[model samples]
Target: MILEVATITLRSGNADEYVRVMPDAFPVLASTPGYIRHELHRGIERPDVFTLFVWWESVEAHNVNFRESDRFPRWRAVWGHLMEGAYVEHFAQVY
Candidate 1:
């Protein structure tokens, strides 16, 4: 499986709004092919920062299947406006 980790920074005071709209965006991601599960973590020291973890069957599932699909825009529409920037990376279990 592939783990996609995205560190997202939101516009000031938009954290609450971002969390509120997440449920609405989840469905778009859940419906994608090879999607396994996901989780959202808020920064303790930085309220405007969040980490999103998504599990996919393969790298292509995220890089191509999801990002390249029309669903990308649909997903973005839910909370894209709240985000200032993001850094995303993928990982594989070592053990």
Candidate 2:
């Protein structure tokens, strides 16, 4: 399994806009092949910080396929303005 977490700090006063604008992109990614689940998490200690957790069958399933798709550019464009400091990482774990 592959889990990707994207942590973003929205520009001041743009949190609402960021949340409101994500639905347009989220559904597409959620429906992609190999997609398992996705969740938007709000930081407990930081209000402006948000994390997107995306689970996929494999890294290639999410990274290679999703990143190269046309929909990704659209998603990026939609959220570009609201993003201030963003960091994304992938992790693996054994259950």
lDDT of 1: 0.98
In lDDT terms, how accurate is model 2? 0.84
Q: Which lDDT tens digits does candidate 1 get at residues 6-72?
A: 9999999999999999999999999999999999999999999999999999999998989999999
Per-candidate TM equals: 0.98, 0.88
The per-model lDDT (C-alpha) reads 0.98, 0.84
Q: Output the TM-score of candidate 2.
A: 0.88
Across residues 1-95, which tens digit of lDDT does each residue of candidate 2 receive? 88999999988778888888888878778767788999998777887889999998988888777888876777788887888988888889877
User: Where does candidate 2 clash, by residue pair?
Assistant: none
User: How many collisions per candidate?
Assistant: 0, 0
Off by over 4 Å in 1: none
Worst 10 residues of 1 by lDDT: 62-71
After the best TM-score superposition of candidate 1, give how far the Cα of residue 56 lies from its true spot, in angstroms: 0.5
